[model samples]
Structures are given as C-alpha cells and as structure tokens.
Target: MMLWITIKVALRSLWANRMRSILAMLGIIIGVGAVIFVLSLVAAAKADMMGRITAMGTNLLVVSPGQRGTGGVMSGTQQNLTADDAEALLAKIPQIRDLAPVVRGNVQAKRLAKNSRTSLMGTTVTYFPIRSFEVEKGRLFNDADCDAMSRVAVIGATTATNLFGTEEPCNQVIKLNSINFRVIGVLKSKGDQGWFNPDDQVLVPYTVAMKQIVGVDHLNEIDIRANNEADLDTIMDRATKLLRKRHHLQEDQDNDFSIRNQAEMLKTADSMNQVLALLAGGIASISLLVGGIGIMNIMLVTVTERTREIGVRKAIGAKNGDILRQFLIEAVVMSGSGGAIGVLSGFVLAAILSRVTSLQASVSLFSVALGLGFSMGVGVFFGFYPASRAARLDPIEALRYE
Candidate 1:
C-alpha cells in the first residue's frame, strides 16, 4: 500500500512538469531507437551473408593453382593445375563425390542490340550440383558436351534478363567474345551474393572455353565435393599429397596448389558480423549515457526545489531511508516510462526504413529487452546521488530555506 502511494506521488510530480519530463527523455529515446534500428539491419545483413555462404556449399573444398606467395604478387594464378590432375584425384580418391575443373574469364555476350558484359565460367556438369545450381529452363550440359567441346552455355538469372529481356533464353545463340555459343539453360535466380555473384555469369564446358575461347591449356581451379561432409579434412589431406607427388615436388619444394574449405568461410563471416554489430551498438549507447547525465542534473534541481517538502515530511516522522526511497522511485518512474515509449518508436522507425530501402531490417525480442534494460539501468545509476543528497539534508535548515 505504501509503495503504491509512493508511485502515485511520483506520477503526480511527473504530470505536474510534463514538458520537462519529455525533454529529459529525448536523449534516451534517440539512443534506444538507434540501437534498435542499427542492430536489426545488422542482423538482417548477417543472415543474408550466411545464406550466401551456405549456398556455396559447406561440404566443399576448392583447389587453386596459386597461394598468393610471399608479398602476394600474383600476375595471375599459376598454370599448374590441369585436367589430368583433376582426373587423377577423382580416380584415386573414392572419398570424392563430385569434381569440376574450372576456369573463368570476363567476356562480352551480345544478342542483337543488347550487349551484357559478364564473367564466363568454364566447368563440367558436376559444377551445378556442387554449387547447388538449378536449371530453370532447358537442361545443363552433359559429359558428351564437355568431350565434344560443345559451344553450349548456361546463363544466370541476371545475365538472362540482360541478354534476353522477357523472352526465354533457352536455345538462343549469343556471342561471347565474338564466338557464338548456344544458351541451353537459364539458372534459377540466386540473387546477388555480395563479393561473388552467382547470378551474373555464363557457364560453358571447360573444354570449349579452354580450346577455343580463352586459349588456356591449364585449369584455373578444381572444385571438389566429398562423398560425405565428414570426409572433408581427410580428402583435403590426401588430395594435397597426391598433387605434390604428381608434380614430382621434392621434400624441400613448396606446394604449387592451395585448398580452401567451406568451414573457414563460415567462421570468417560469423566473426566479422559480430564485430560490425558491436561497433554499431557501442556508438548508439553514447546517447544513453548522455541521457543518464541529463536525468542526474534534473533530479538535482528537483531536490533543491523540493527542499521544504522534504523538511515537512521529515518533521512528520519520515525516516532518512523513506526520503531516499521516494526520490529514487520518482526517477525510475520517469526513465521506465521513457524506455517504453522509446521501444515503440524504434519499431516504427525500423519498419519505415525496411519499406523505403533495399535494406532488410528485422526487430528481435533480444534487442527490445536490451534497450529497455539499459534505459532503466541509466535511471538507477544517475538518480542515486540526488536521492542520497536529499536524504542527508538537515530538516531545520531545509525548513528555514526561503
């Protein structure tokens, strides 16, 4: 009953100075809202990134011909990997489920008046299943196509749009670097994947791309899939040993090839995403501190203005602890109210941003809880000194004050 009376008193005092209370809350409102807005967008971006990484395959290991070397001087990848190396690895290692020898270059693809510049990827049929690509129209090329060095291609969704517009791309012949290639399939849209876009390219048999187009005799990379995800590490080790022996490297020679696992990509993405979220949250938290200081200053002024009231209550048998409790409760009420309002505003602002921009933003229960808890914490920390000072005042001196 006494606690309820104290709460009622706090509310009445706040209502009496409504304008001052709102001004005091402005800083906290901005702080909490910013925390919500920035964190939600960060969360969304992280989800999108993880999805892209997963799409590349968590069971994958890519073998490349170069490792950037001492000073990272790379005119291009070393011309070390070849189709024979890929074939030897596949035959020797039963752990290998699928493999594709890949080479890539940029080319201008033209059809009539429409011209689109895109990266051209050259690999076997296994590249589709390994990379989780689906054929939306027509079919992916087969072993015969690679053997015959067929000038057949698969186009990504973005590339499909660029070259064919609304018309179907299947069975259409487009010119790549002035060389005619038939588009046998159009891949389902995978959207943009930031650093590497799967939906902005053309794919043809490595044989065709090497013999006639880019005129390269060596493989740029080999994308390998293990028979089981558990076999990834073992297969990587075995493949390394086999490649070293094939190239006749002695014990002193460094590896001319490098292997990359999907797990490393996932770990890197997670750490970078965490760092970004923390940075954004730290910047927004500054406003909460500023608002806390504002609350402390205003509470100090309130204690001074209510000096006579404190003296009257003390004279009427109020204890020092009682006096402290009343002032503290009043400050908490103000902050807690502001916190609730701020959370609502954050939701509204986040929704607006999601609608108006390409940014994907989402609000989570954790962010709301964090903001509210932080605001209440600010109230208690800053409201303490003023409440203690008011409690310590001598009743007689407070009563005599004009």
Candidate 2:
C-alpha cells in the first residue's frame, strides 16, 4: 500500500510539472543514447576487422624488416630483407611450410590509351597458397615463370577492371615501367584489409620485378605460413635464431627483422578496440553524471517549492520515511523513464549510422541493460541528499514558510 501511494504521488507530481520533468530527464536521455550508439558502432567495426584478419589464415606470419607500432610508427631503420633471407629461412627452418618475399612498388599501368596507377607486388608462386588466394581466371605462375624471370603478370580483380574494362585480361599485354607483360591470371577479390586494398594490385614473379622492373634485389616484407598454428612458437624461435645468426647479432641486441603472427595482430587489434570502447564509455558517462547533478538541482528546487506540502503530510500521520520515499521515487521515475527513451532512440541512431557511415555497429544487450541500470543508480545516488533534506525539515518552519 505504501509503495502504491509513493508511485501515485510520483506520477501526480511529474504530471503536474510535465515541462520541468521532461527537462530533468533530457540529460539522461542524451547520455544513454550516446553510449549505445557509439559502443555498437565500435564493436561492429572491431568484429569486422577481426573477420578480415582471420580470413587471411591463422597459421600465417608476417616478417617485416623493421618494427611497426600501433600508429604506423617505425621503431627501427629499414633493413634490407632480401630474397636470400626467404630462401635461407625456407631451407634452414624445417618447420616452415612455405614463404614469399614481397617486393612492392607503385607504377603507372597502361593498356591502350587508358592509364591507371596500381600497386605492383613481386612475389613467388608459393605466395598464393600461403596467403590463401585463389585465381579466379587463368593460372598462377609455374617454376619456369619465376626461373626465366618471364614478363608475365597476374592482376587483381579491381586492377583488371580499371585497366581492361570488362574484357578478359588473360594473355593480354599491359605496359608497366615501359615493359610489356602478358596477363597470365586474374586473382579473386580480397577486398580491403587495414590500410591497403589487396584487389587494387598487380602481381608478378619476384625475379621479374627485381631484375626487369623495380631493379632492386631487396624485399619490403616476407610472408610465411607455418606448418601449423600449434608449431608457431617453435617456428618463430627457430626463424629468429637463424636470422640473428645470419645478421650476426648478439642475444640482447634489438632484432633487425620483426616477426608478427596472425594471433598477435588480432590481439593487438582487440586491445586497441577495447581501449577505444572504454574511452568512449568514459566520455559518455560524464554526460550522465552531469544529468545526475541536474536531477539533484531540480529535486532541491522541488523541496523548496513544496515546503508546505511536506509539512502538511507530516502533520497528517506521514512519517519521515514516507516523504523521503516520495522524492526518491520521483527521481528514479525521471531517470528510468529517460533511460528507456534513450534506449529506443539509440537503436534508431545506430541503424542510421550503419547505413550512412563506414563504422559497423552491433548492439549488445548487455550494454543496453548496463546503461539503464547506471541511470537508475545515478538517480538514487544524486537524489539521496535532497530527499533527506526535505524529510528532516522542521514541521513548524516548513508550514510557516511564505
């Protein structure tokens, strides 16, 4: 019966001051809505990033010449990773399944009068299998192609479209660096991964790229596929030991060659994603705290305006608990109602964001519940002092107030 009465009083008071009640809830609504929208978008984007990385294969490892940080910063000076390192690693590390030395350059491609710039990659025949890429049309290079340093090329799907239109690219000659190379194959699309689009590239045998095109014997990076993911640690250990021996480095010396496994990439990405989520959540929580302060302010004003009411109720057999309960209930109703409204609004905003922005959004039920629970807790926490103040007012003083 007391609960029912308290609820009735809360509803009656809010209905009487509809505008002020709405104003009080406005902060909570915005805060919760922002929490939901931002978190969903970030979660979705992280999941998408992980998915693309996983598709590149789990047992894969990237061996780069210098250390790369999270923000595209390089830790060490660029060391020359050469084809000899690839050959040595393949021969020396029995646990290693396959390897490809990747040499990259930007070149202008011309087919007839049309011209478009594309990223050119020099890689060996083993690169396709190691990277899990399949040829959509024609075939990959054979040993002869690599041995003879043939002027043959394999273009990615997007590169093919830009340089050849809808026409078949197989056996067609395209000019790169003033040399005509026959397109022997076209790679199936891999879309975009991180900073680069795999589909926006043209590939050729590493030897051809080194001798005929780029004229550099050094490699940019090396792609390695371990025999299995379980053997990755052993493989990394052996590879590191071999490279250090080859480069003649001491044990404590910083490595000239850096190895990154697929798992590390995913873990790094996940850590960054988690940090971003926390930052976003922290920023959004500030708005809720501000809204809680607003609730406290409004409740104090309410206590002042309703001084006579408090006195009358106290005189009419209402206990101090009753007065406190009424005000607390009112604050909770304001925040709870606002939280509900915010959740609905957030869903709409998240949907719109997914359609309009590149950020992928996946809404978690945990986040929604957490937002509402947080709002309710904030209401109680901020409302307590004001409710207690109203309850402790002297009946005589309250009743005599002008």
Candidate 3:
C-alpha cells in the first residue's frame, strides 16, 4: 500500500510538469529509436547477403589466381589458373563432384536494336550444376559446345529483360564484342549478391570465351563442387598439392592460387556484418548516454524545485526510503514511457524502410527488449543520485527556505 502511494505521488509530480518530463524523455526516445532502426536495417542487409551467398551453392569451392609478389611487393593477381589446372584437379581429387574453369569479361551485348553492357562468363556445362543455377527457358549449353568452341550463349533473367524486354530471348542471336552468338538458354533469377549480380551476366562456353571474346589462355577462376562438405578440406589440400606439382613449384614456394570454400566465405561475411552492426549500435548508443545525463540533470533540478515539498513530506513522518522511492519511480515512469514511444517509432521506421527501399528490415524481439531494458537501466542509474539527495535533505532547513 505504501509503494502504491509512492507511485501515485510520482505520477502526480511528473504530471504536474508535463512539458519538463517530456523534454527530459526526448533524448531517450531518439536514442532508443536510432538503435532499433540501425540494428533492424543491419540485420536485414546481413540476411539478404547471406541468402545470396547461400544461393550460390552448397559444398562449393572457388579457386582464383593469387596476387604475385615482385621484389617482396605484392602486385595485382597472377593469371595462373588455367583450364588444364581445373582438369588436373578433377582427375586427381576424387572428392570433387564437378568443376568449371571460368573466364569472364564485361562487354556490350546487342540483340537486334536492343543493347546492354553486362558481364559475359565463359564456363562449361558443369557450371550450371556447380552454381545450382537452373535454366528457365530452352537449355544450357553442353560440354560438346565447349569442346567444339560453339558460339552459344545463355542469358540471365535480368540480361534477358534488359536486351529483349517482353520478347522471348531464346533462339535470338546476341552479339558480344561484335561476334554473333545464338542464345540457347535463359537463367532463372538469383537476385543480388552484394558486390555481384548473377542475374546481370551472360554465360557462354569457356573455349569460345577464351578464343573469341576474353582472348585469354589462362582462366580467371574455377568453381568446384565437393561431393560432401566433410571432404572439402582434404579436397582443397589435394588440389593445392596437385596444382603445385603441375606448376613445377618447389615445396618452399608459395602457391600462386587461392582456394575459398562457401562455409569460410559465409563465416567471414557473418563476422563482417557483426562488426558493422556493433559499430552502428555503438554510435547510436551515445544518444542514450546523453539522454541518461539529461535525466540526471532534470531530476536534480526537480529536487531543488520541490525542496519544501520534501520537507513537508518528511515532517509528516514520510521516511527517507519513501522519498527515495517516490523520486526514483518518477524517473522510471518517464523513461519507461519514452522507451514505449521509441519502440513504436522504431517499428514505424523499420516499416518505412522496408517499403521505401529494397531492404527488408526486420525487428527482432531481442532488440526491443534491449532498448526497453537499457532505457529503464538509464533511469535507475541516473535517477539514484538525485533521489538520494532528496532523501538526505535536512527537513528543518528545507522547510525554513523562503
């Protein structure tokens, strides 16, 4: 019953100066809102990135040429990966289910009157299976096409839309670098993958790409599908050793290539997202700290304004603990209200972001809980000193004040 009375008094005090209370809560409101908004956006972006990376394939490994060092100074990537290297790895490593040596270039693709600049990849038929890509229309080019150096092309969904619009792109001839190639397939949309948009590229046979388009004898990269994830490390080690032997590199020499697996890439991506989220959250949290200080400052002023009221209460047999509880409850009420408002505002902001942008902002319960808890904690931490000061006031002195 005494606690209830103290709460009632706190509410009354806060209600008496509604504007001041609101002003005191403004910092917390903005702080909590900013934290939620930043976290939600970051979570959404991370999910989107992970989803895109996962879509690339399971149990997959990518091999790319490593940077070469010239006189102890690292230079640009070495063009060391070749179709022969890919073949050697496949022949030597039983863990590899499928592999494709790739060469790519950015070129203007023209089909009749329509044209679009897009990445053109030259890979084998196994590229489709290795990357888990499905052909939406017609068919993917086969190994026979790669071996025969056929001028056949497979367009991605975005590429199809950009060049052909509503018209069907399959069977149409698209010219890449002034060389005509018949479109045999259209790939299903895989959406954006952050740095790369798989849907915006075209695929052709590696032989044709090497000889006619990119004009490079060396491969840019190799996409390999491991039979199982458990065998990935063994496969990588074996492939690395085989490649080293094929390149005639000594045991002490560094590898001229790099091997990256899907799991490692996903882990790295997750770590990066976590760091970004923490950085954003840390920056936003400064407002919360400022808000806490504001609460402390306001509570101090409130104590001064109500000095005689405190005296009157103490003179009427109210204990120091009761006075402390009253002021503390007042601070908590103010901050709690601000936290509720901030949460609503954060949700609205998240919804607006989702609607206005491509990002799919997601609000987790953890974030909501964290915001509310932090706000209440701030109230308690900052409210304590002022409440204690009010409780410790000399009743006679306070009552004698003019």
**89-118: candidate 1 lDDT, tens digit per residue:** 999999999899999989999998999989
Query: Scored by Cα lDDT, where does model 1 land?
Result: 0.88
Off by over 4 Å in 3: 1-4, 11-20, 44-52, 70-73, 111-115, 318-325, 348-362, 388-397, 400-402
Q: Write down the worst ten-residue block by lDDT for model 1.
A: 67-76
Q: Residue by residue across 173-266, what tens digits does model 3's lDDT show?
A: 9999899999999998887777789999989999999999988999999999988889889998998888888888997888889899987888
Query: What does candidate 2 score on TM?
Result: 0.82
* Residue 174 in model 3: lDDT: 91
How close is every model to the real structure, measured as TM-score? 0.81, 0.82, 0.86
In candidate 3, what residue range of length 10 has the lowest lDDT sum? 2-11
> TM-score: which is higher, 1 or 3?
3
List pairs with backbone clashes in candidate 3.
none
